[model samples]
Target chain A: MFVTLWRMITFGFQNFFRNIWLSLITVLIVVLNLFLMSLVSGLNVVGQQTLTAVRQKVDLSVYFIPTTSEQRVDQIRQELLRKPEVQSIRLITRAEHLQELKKSAVDKGLVDAAIDALGDNPLGAGLVITSKTLDGYGAIANTLKDPKYQSIIEDTGNNFQTNQTVISRLSLIVNRVQVATLWLTLLFAVIAILMVFNTIRVAIYSQREEIGIMKLVGASDAFVRGPFVITSLLYGLVASILVTAVLVPILSLTNPFFAQFFAGYDINVLGYVREHLWTILGLEVAVGCGLSVISSLFAIGRYLRV
Target chain B: MVTFEHVTKTYQRRNVGLEDVSVNIEAGEFVSIVGQSGSGKTTFAKLIIAEEKADKGHITIGGWNITHIKHHEIPTLRRQIGVVFQDFKLLPKKTLFENVAFALEVAGERATRIKSVVPQVLKIVGLEQKMDRYPDQVSGGEQQRVVIARALVHRPKLLVADEPTGNLDSINAQEIIALLKKINEFGTTVVLVTHNREIVNMLHKRVITLDHGHVIADQQAGKYLL
Candidate 1:
């Protein structure tokens, strides 16, 4: 049995190499299918990683009323930090804000413009509220605008009209991208399956007479189907290696650019994408093997009657 | 020994294959079943191999009932009966040696057994010199000889050849008949199904003639009688 199986394996490889053009065509189709799946799945990973990092950068800045006493502002900061949603809070005084502005200015021209336009450093002391979770930021942002804080606070930066619209639109675009990628992945998966199905069907058609003759010569059913099964397995194995070899470098090349955009948060955006390497490979092989086996089995069962 | 009792086969539910066929051949007898097209000769050959099951009646080869044989059991049954078809049935991609050893491989014969039996059979078919050649590389007669060698590896009790020489020239046809006769001389029952009237006439062996699914004649030392 071992020798026969070994001979069958060798025969399968011999047949594959003997007809190089057909084998190349089959491998090309499988590679294209697996490549599309890997690309879609890989991009989805990066997109989600970027979105989560963006959400972690959210913070609410509560500016104190200009006339409020320093002690009153400090008392409001202490009260706000006690809230369950607040992960951390820091108070920025007007003088500190002016100092930060001067440090951010690249030249004397901007600093002189800022001093003349404002006349008297008009910036107020504000409380910066960082939330533990992005989902809870909206509720915390709303708390800063409550009537109870009207005596101590003037306005919250988180409630600015432009900032609200920009954040919501970015979230919306990310969600749309996710939905679109999912649909595209599903569509490409179906096409890949059909492509493999037709390839295997054509293979079985080409081998129909040979299989029939083998059956007539007292070859068992397993013996007759053995070569084709091994053929599919070889196709899947090769396609998976090709996909993984190509995808890893592609992911690595794009990681740095993605990382720079997500620098404000603690997340290693690229690390998340790289961690799923085995999963991507597993999915590719599973898809490749599954499509080939099912297609060949169904086609052979229908065509090879004997 | 092979026996077909009241065996009937229908193809496509309308076309007749074989109808109410009954016959018996003892061990070591070389019998020729003769018929023209649509006369159930090929159908009778397929029945014995369990390729097509009989609609009614029993088929016993070497005392094993094959009428209700399971699909999985067909392989073991086939291993016991050597079959040669009209097409020669040699795998075109395989060499002559691999073609003959394929039967033994399917039967799970040991590598040593295959290595031992294959060349011996090839020598018997007189294609030992051409064993390395492929089916396309060899002549039709040589390919048919390879198939006969493949059939003999099992040492089956019954050898059923359905027009084994249909595609060969007269010289090759005679050689094949002689080879079958020689095999019968060694005590293997041989059943040759053919439309070659001349070869059947010359054999002077037992003949079973079928016409439209019914046996028209059963005679010892039968001639090519229509």
Candidate 2:
């Protein structure tokens, strides 16, 4: 049994190198499949991060009357913090709001004019409220509308209807992108499978005479079939290694661009890829080897009758 | 040590490959089957190796009836009988040594046994010096010798040569015939199928002549009579 296995392994290498061009073409296809799978996963991570960042920026602010005391604003801040839906609430004093406006005006070269016109701080104190989810925003807005706080409140940004519309539209776009990526991934996967199948079939067809000779020499089915199957598995294995070698460097180079794209979102695409490198490569190897083996089995079944 | 008892075979389209053919050869006999094209010569060779099943009757090699041999058992039957074809079906990429050793490898022989037996068989066919050459690197006669060497690796009880010299020139054909004769002298049954009248006449051995899927004559010391 050991002798037979060694012979099969050696013959498999002989077959692989003997048809070098065809083997390379098969490996190339497997590489493309694995690369596309990784690309889809990367896009998914980036897309989720971008949507979360956009949603995080969509918070409501509760403005207080200028005469409201600092104590009252602090009480409102503490009450909002206790709510489960509220992620955070920051108290923006009138003076702090003026300072923020002045910094932005400086960027536009209108700082001096804006400060002269508003001698005293006309901006009201406010609370900036963030919720854990987009759906929670509506509940938080309703809670602020209670009569107890109406007297001191100058304006409550309770545009729930408009906010809901914007969130739904964003959700629609993100969902569509995910769906399209899935379909594209599936389509390419099918094409890659067919190409591998045909490549293996041609490889086996070229060895028809050799197969006949083996049968005449009294080779059993497993002995004759072993070399071709092993050759295909090698194609998958080598392709996976090639893809990882190429992908790691490419992903590293693109990390800065991805980080810039999701600047304030705290999304670390490179970190994600690094953490899941083995899992990603493992999935690719499984897929690559799986396709090659199945293709080889079918091709051998059709061509190697002996 | 081979027997065909009332065997019949018909191919698709109702073409007759063999018709109620029955023959027997004792141990260590050299027999030649001669016929015209489409006269069941190739079919008879195919049947002996179980490449084609007989439509009727039975074939037994050394008391083993193989009329209804299962698919998995075909390999075992072939290992016992060495078969050679006119085309010399050697793997083009494999060297002469690898080609010969392939027979033993397929039968799961140990590496030591393969290393020992393959060289011995190649030496018998006078190809020991050319063992490193690929099939395409050798002449037509040398390729056929490698095929024969491969056939002898198993030390089979019977060797069947189907038009083994069909692709060779006159001198090469004579050499192959001489080699087959030498192999037969070593107590192995040799069944040579051919249409070459000169070689057949020179053998002066038992000859079975077939015409249209039926045996016309079986003669001791036959003279290639049509």
Per candidate, native contacts kept equal 0.49, 0.78
Question: Candidate 1, what DockQ?
Answer: 0.63
RMSD of each: 3.7, 3.5
lDDT of 2: 0.85
DockQ of every candidate: 0.63, 0.71
Provide interface RMSD per model, one decimal.
Answer: 1.6, 1.3
- Candidate 1 docks at the CAPRI level of medium
The positional error of residue A225 in candidate 1, measured at the CA in angstroms, is: 2.6
Q: Identify the CAPRI category of the predicted complex in candidate 2.
A: medium
DockQ of 2: 0.71
- Residue pairs that clash (backbone atoms under 3 angstroms), model 2: none
Clashes of each: 0, 0
lDDT of 2 by residue, A1-306 (tens): 777888889999998898788788878877887677667666766776777777778787778888888788999899989999999998899888777777777364566566678776677788888888777777887787788877788855446557657766765776787688777767766777787777767777878778877887888888888898899889888888888788889979998997787777778877877888898778777877888888888877754455
